[model samples]
Target: MKNTVLITGSSTGFGAAAANYFAAKGWNVIASMRDTSKDKQLNKQENIFVTHLDVEDTASIDAAITAGLARFGKIDVVINNAGYGLFGIFESFTKEAIQQQFAVNLFGAMDVAKAILPHFRAQQSGVLINVSSGAGVVGFPNASIYNASKFALEGWSEGLRYELAAIGIKVRIVEPGGATQTDFLQRVWGEGKNASIIPDYIPFLQKSEEMYANLGANSDEDAVEKIVAALYAAATADDDQLRYAPTSDIQPLLNVRRSSSEEEFNSFTNGLFLGK
Candidate 1:
C-alpha cells in the first residue's frame, strides 16, 4: 500500500522540497503550512494536499492532523520541519524570543508527536522524522538560542525512538549543516537590545551576518536532497539508525565530539568562540 506523509511548514524550504520529493516518489503528501492560501506552489501539485497548520497553535495542529487523517486515510509519517532560528548573541536574546524558539521548534514537534502517537499505536507502524541541525550536537557563536532548541529536539527524538520501538513507530533525527539558499536565515530574528549591551560580541555578530548574507553556508539543494533520502530510508530501511548527519562537515565534527575528551572539545569550542 502507498503511504501518506504529513509535512509541517511545507510552504517553503526543506519542508516544501521534501513534500515534492515524496509526492514524486508515489506517496500522498499532506503539505502543511500556517496558511494554505499563502502556499501557492504547493497547492498546484496533483499529489499534494495543502492544509493549514500553525505549529505554535495547539488548536491548529490538532485540526490539521484530523483533516490530514480524514483526507488521506492514513498518515504513515510525520515530518516536523516547522521551525525558525533566532540568531543572536547569547546575552542579547530576550525571554520572549527564546520562548518562541522552543515553542515552535521543540514544543511544536512534541505536540505533533503526542497527537499522532495514538494513531500510530493503533496502526502499529509509523515513522517520525525531526529536522534538527548540526547545531543540535555542536554549539556555535551568536546562535545560542537556536542551538538550544535543536538540542532539545535531538534529546526528545532520542528518547521517543526507544519508547516507540516496540510498537514499530520509529523516530529519526536529520542534522543538516548551514544551508543558505532558504528563507530560514531570513526568518531568523535577533534582539538588538540584548546584543547591543554585549559590546565585545558586535564584531563577531557583524562577521556572522556578512557570512549569512553572502551565502557562505552550504547549498540548500544538496541539503534538501539529503533530507529526502534520509526520510525515504527511515520509512523503509531494514536497519535502525538513530541519527542522520546530512552535511559532510558536520559528520566529522560529530564524530570528534562523540569520541573526544571533554577537555579537548571544550578547548576547540573555546578557541572558535574567541576567534569569532
Candidate 2:
C-alpha cells in the first residue's frame, strides 16, 4: 500500500514544494493549509488532497485530521510545517505578538501532534517531522522570539522522540538554514512594544536579512527536495536520526557549534554580527 503523508502549511513555500515532491514520488499527499480555498494548485493534483487545517484552532486541527484520515485511509506521516517568523527586537515585541508566535509555532505544532498521537499509538507506527529552522539549534541576532519558538520545538521533539520510539512513533527535526522566497521574511510581524522606537538591535536584523537574502545560489528546489527526502527517511528508517540539517550552511554551523567551546562559538557568532 502507498503511504499517505499530511503536510501542514502546504499552500506555499517548503510545505508546498515538499507536497509536490512526495506526491510525484507516489505518496498520497495531503496538502493542508488554513484555507484550502486559497490553494488552487494543490487542488489540481490527482494524488494530492488540499484540505483546510488551521493549527491554531483545535477544532480545525481535529477536523482536518478527520478529513485527511477519511480521504487517505491512513496517515503514516505528518510534516508540522505550519509556522511563521516574528522578527524585530525582542524588547519591542508585545505580549500579543509573543503569544501569537508561540500559538502558531510551538503550541500549534504540539496540538497537531496530540491530535494525531491517538491514531499513531493505535497503529503503533507513525512519524512526526517538524519543520524547525537552523535557529532551532542556535540563536542569531534580532530573532530571539522566532528562535525561542524553534528552540521550544527542538526541546519537544527531543523528549518526544525517546518517549515514542518504543511505541513505533518516530520524530525528527529539520533545520534548514535559509530560503529567501518563503513568505517567512516578507510576512514578518514586529512586536509593537518597541518596534516603532527602533532598538539598537535593528541593525543586526537588517544585516541578517541582507545576508540571508543572498543565499540559495541555485534553485531552492534542491534544498526542498532534500528536506522532503529527509522527512521520508525519518518516517521510514528503523533507526532514524533525531535531527536532519537540510541546508549547506546549517550542517556546517551545527557541526561547529557542537564541537566548539562556548567561548569559541560566541566569538564566531559575534564576528557574524560584526560582519567579519
By summed lDDT, the worst window of 10 consecutive residues in model 2 runs over 184-193
**TM-score to native of every candidate shown:** 0.88, 0.89
**Backbone clash count, each prediction separately:** 2, 1
- What are the candidates' C-alpha RMSDs? 3.0, 2.9
Give Cα-based local distance difference scores for all models: 0.79, 0.81
Scored against the true structure, residue 184 in model 1 reaches a CA lDDT of: 28
Please give, for residues 19-38, the per-residue lDDT of candidate 1 as tens digits.
88899899999998997777
Candidate 2 lDDT, tens digit per residue, 47-139? 898888999999988998898889889999999999987776677667888889899999999999999999999989999999999888888
Residue pairs with backbone atoms closer than 3 Å in model 2 (clashes): 92-194
